[model samples]
Target: MAGAGSWFVEQPPAEPPAEASASFERLYRAFLSARAALGLALVMAQLISVVLGTTPARSTLALSLSYAVAALALWLAPQLRRGASARSLARISSPHWWSAIGVDLILFGVLHALDPSGVNYGALFVMPVLMAAVLSPRMLALATAAMATLGLLGAAAWSLLAGLDVGLKTTQAGLVGSGLFAVSLLAGELSARLAREEKAARGSLALARQQELLNRLVIDEMQEGVLVVDRRGRIRAMNPAARSLLGAASGELSWQLRGRADWQPLVLALERAYGGSAGEGGAEVDVALALDSGAARSLRLRLRFTRQREGSEELCVLFVEDNRELLARTRQEKLAAMGRVSAGIAHEIRNPLAAIAQANALLAEDVAGGRAEQLTRMVASNVQRLKRLVDDVSELAPGMQPDTQPLDVSALVQETCEDWVQVNGVEPGAQSRFRLHIGAPGLTGLFDAEHLRRILVNLLDNAHRHAEPGAGAIQATLDRHGDALDLVVRSAGAPVPHEIERHLFEPFFSTRSRGSGLGLYICRELCERHGARIDYRRATDAAANEFCVRLRTPSSASSA
Candidate 1:
């Protein structure tokens, strides 16, 4: 088993490739500055030799000027590298590099030749070779190293052949050559490794940016609301849905939500999430907001806490979900289940109810006297009423599948409205009271014809009951745009009561005492079955109430 301390030992953090490259570049410049200073010192030594009469004045002056020129080039190297892009910086010019190496090699050879007695300058050639290793390709660096070695030996050979008293020896030249080749090999390998790491670091940076973009898209498209707040209670980020939920304007991007009166609930919930009051399950809070229209609305929201520690600061993430949506979904599921059970029960009850009607008819036939006739008539009316009730209740049983087909929208709607008018005549003293506005008469829609007729009749019946009687009293508008058709029914009437508006389409909910409360609910179910939506709104210009049905085209209906 490993020791406890070994297991706990922390690994050194890896340096980012970009940062490492920058550091290496700085170090390379420092090396150049050091070489330049050494060259300047060498030039000063030659001047001293001339002043001391140890070397000829003419040769020393030339050598000093040549060495001074090389040193000046080395000092200016760092400035040339500044203000370049990464790719440009990574790439070294082959011509510039060759030129520098040639100048140094030639000058060092001449300086060595000029020195017949003391101080061989051949070793200075290693500076140019090492620089080539740092800035050039591996093969070129090795070649430069070989050239530098040959230049050192050639200077020594020239001294031996020319009968000059040179201080340089063959052994010193060989040792310097071997050292340069080793430095070149090591430097080349290190530079190549640095390049690979820099490339990887750049790739990692790009991937991070892509992930951030994807995360932004998902958050923007989410149905639920989300808000991120920092330790100082500043709202850092919010998606579109959250802004809509709070009734905030699009420009309210930087408002402080910490202690504002309108956003107190949000602030409190955030506090609970961060203050340890909320458990692992978070907190579920119900809030009520009074709208600008003086309408009070209640909302169920779930608050989730996500804590992220950043350095010395704590960042808390608050995820807000509207639980009213959850409740609505749950209600729809219950209704579906109830529909199945009610359908089963209605099927069983239907046969017995029919038998009772038949028995009542048989009794009416047997009794046909003065007092018995009156009683028989009363029994017949009650039996008929009971039958109608049973039929209506059975209709509420769910699973009423629609047989959808492509049908001309305007023609079908006009025909259904005509039937309704014939069955229930319009209010008295009304001329052209019922109008038809068909923007696209031949447009086709995906819907069940029978179900469509029922929906129209139900809406028209309500309109006739609530609308005033006269010309232009009721209008049915049919319009088509691309893949959708709209059917709107409007009439003059006071707006529906706010208290009853929300539950208007719910089963067993009705404003009228005599109504069964399933008319509009059944209409909604029928419309939704055919991938359509029905909504009610009071027109802005007048007190005309409107019911608009949006029916999808046959090809795109399934997506609705």
Candidate 2:
């Protein structure tokens, strides 16, 4: 009995272990059901005995009815304890050998002791033994089997004292005890093995879920677009980059690829991959999508397939990249390399340029008013142009921060326009080719004064080159736009061609044979450094070509 007491000793955990608690509750409920059924069977057996005229004792009938009622109460306990804490529920639901097994042992032992019709009640002991084996610890299970063995032997010894066949009864009791012991050990080991497998399965499921979330996060943040599509042209999944590249709305996640005209190229690429035109590794294709904006966007697509195993559908993974962006990135890399080389070349040219300027100045002094004087002047002008070119190229090198300060934009624009007109020899007054209009006085902006001057000079020069020689052929206006200032230089001319407009600010792109092509590029670069923007458009109201520079005001810069 002391060994049997070990079955009831359980330490309540602070927090119930999920897997262990669930497993115990499940097994506990199943055994409770078994106990209830057994109790009913015992009551039915007693009633049948009475109907057959082999009436059992009144005490036996009372014991069977009591067991049935006890079993029913235990089975219904879990439903009454709902919403309880884990520790509380665990205590109520945990399978203890005493709850089911101990009750069954006492009932069977009493029934065996009070045998009325000489029925063998020893077989009933197997129920408690088997229940203990499956639900209790190994030592507890063995202890339970030993207790049942003692009960059987005691019954056999009592029968011998009553002059029954003692030898036969003792041998049967010994054999039954041996079988019970074996069942207990074997069942306990199998139960432990099952628990281990269940725990491993739970860990694997948790790990797989974590990995899935991490993969989704990584894909969403990727710069390149990623799409997962099945063979049926259905877009199963797509990351944010993919949605942006496809111009698809965020909520249009599950749409078919073939539903839209712009998506036909993707459908064809998917078909090619599935139709085996794509290699085992994957395929790459260039596609053009005509968007709602009436513009054709180019994309480079690489399609790869998941390994097609039996019983699983094959999926295609499409990696999409905007071809224009790819080209821009490649161009930037090339430009970076070119900048390094150009910086070196500009440095080497500086010494020679200085020597050439010195020689030109010395030579100009010796010349009189003749072709020699004109030649020296041209040499000096050309040298100045070379120096300007070198300066523009050097500006392209990395790590040049703008030295910005608050300045009067109105005064700068007026001064720059006046100086440009004088330098380019434009006549002032009613018939002046260049007209300057200052809309507001004391309009201050944040800018590098030198950079702003260079930007204005470049824009004025471009306007001068394109403007017809007449009154107001070019107009430079400064005005306020929101919290910023806009300096618009409009020149009377036909609008720039669309083909050339796209590359208007690109480096080394010029229509003239001798044009260095860095004027607008350097202007754009300078504007960007000063946190401003410059763009070109045909002014519809003025019916002229306009280059507008939007300068950041001090207040706007401060707020930003």
Candidate 3:
């Protein structure tokens, strides 16, 4: 009975050692083949002498000479092995080349002079085998044919010049030997070609297997899912990670879509935004999927599509990203940083604000009967403003969470703009009148209403304070898209100064004589807390210098 831990014991499989040993085995076989070829030559010499049936003395002399040659070959084997494996196999002239021809000629002369046998032409067979091993197949065949021709010419010259029998047996032997040499040469060439082809095939098979393994290794290691699908949308290939992310086997994805159909909405959103360059679009909404126990968890999916050539067919490779943990961790870090900064500021500024409030109250009572009363009131008002500023700073701490709910963002923008118009008292015929152009209706989203209202008010106030007198009034428009919102507040007046634009959102940074300077900074902070981003930009085509703040609609679950 094994424990559950023992049942799940993990260990690496043994494959690499097996492959290495197989490689060594191939090299050893090649070494043995070269050695066997050399041994064949020695064995052939002994067989030839035995078949000739010469006298004991003559046969012994021939056998001793062959043995001596074999011994010399053995001594050179090490050097031959070293040289043969270097670069190309060492090109060498056959040992019995011209000398073998000379021996054949002498043998013909002896048959003419001594008239031993009418025909004994066994030695000519060795030339073709030796040539095949040493040279290329085509060259070996040509050389062997030439040697056969030369042998025929030598045999004719011997018979005619010596006035010998010139009989049928001698003529037939020359013709038959030449024919055998040519046949043997052709056979050897075919054998060599087949051998080479087999070797190449083996090498190709090994490389293909290795590449497949490498692909599997890479696919298994990736964190994202990668699926290659044909134009018809049938998956053609997938990595192991892709299969796991899709909650299926790689084999299954080849012909079907994996995962839930709920992914389609996000997929369509991504496809629309990214174009064909990215197959899927970034998730604009928090994804909730029913998992075990019907438990719903949030996930952010990014899909991308790319065209690639697979054989002759074009395929779309899909890349899927899971950003749930990444998004959560990012939020956690931001909150932690905000907390530390808030704690430090409270320690440094809260006590000072309290003291200032007490001092102002005392001064107000004492200076009630003089012009000094005016100064005391001013001091008290400034102290109250400072306390408000401190409160705004404290709002930036980590614990400050946005209360998000479904609301009409357009309505919120219009309401805030109207409030700004009323506070600034911009009359219809005033030098700087304020205007609002609300975009088409039904534009809604989920957002922190209070925070959004603040964002609009901040921008409108900035425009009111900076508008040049006698210039065209400010016109603010609240525009909407399918999943995004924007506020363009344009003042038809002087362009914003470059210096002011640079430090517009820095805390405690202000250009006005008596401004708190924390308004824009607070707006930016609130927007970020709600996972919305805002930026200021001058309009390129409009007559008035325009500043814009774009917010991601709640439906757009974009990163903070």
RMSD of each: 8.6, 5.2, 23.2
Angstrom error of the Cα, residue 267, model 2: value is 5.3
Residue lDDT tens for model 2, 1-560: 11211121232222226655676667767877988898899999999998999879987888889889888877878653343322232132343434567778888877775676667777888888777766665566787789888888888888878888778768877998898898887776666556555556767888899999999999999999999998889999999999888888878877788889888888987887789746448999999888766778899999988888899988889999999999999998998898889988998999999999999999999989989999999999999999989988888777777888999989988888888888899888898888888888999999988889988998898898988767998999999999999999999988899999999999899999889899999889888988999999898886699999999998998899
Candidate number that wins on lDDT, 2 or 3: 2
Q: Quick one: ranking by TM-score, best first?
A: 2, 1, 3
By descending lDDT, how would the candidates be arranged? 2, 1, 3
- Candidate 1 residue spans exceeding 4 A from truth: 1-94, 120-123, 162-168, 243-273, 277-312, 322-446, 460-495, 525-560
lDDT score for candidate 2 against the true structure:
0.82
User: Which candidate number has the best lDDT?
Assistant: 2
Q: What is the lDDT of residue 559 in candidate 2?
A: 90
- Compare candidates 2 and 3 on TM-score and give the better one: 2
Candidate 3: segments with Cα more than 4 A from true spot: 1-13, 17-28, 31-35, 38-343, 346-348, 351-372, 395-405, 421-432, 440-442, 470-472, 506-509, 513-517, 540-543, 558-560
Model 2 Cα shift for residue 343 (angstroms): 3.3
The lDDT for every candidate, in the order shown, is: 0.70, 0.82, 0.57
lDDT for position 225 in model 1: 77
Candidate 2: stretches off by over 4 Å: 1-27, 44-57, 76-196, 221-225, 229-279, 287-299, 309-313, 322-325, 401-422, 425-446, 469-480, 553-560
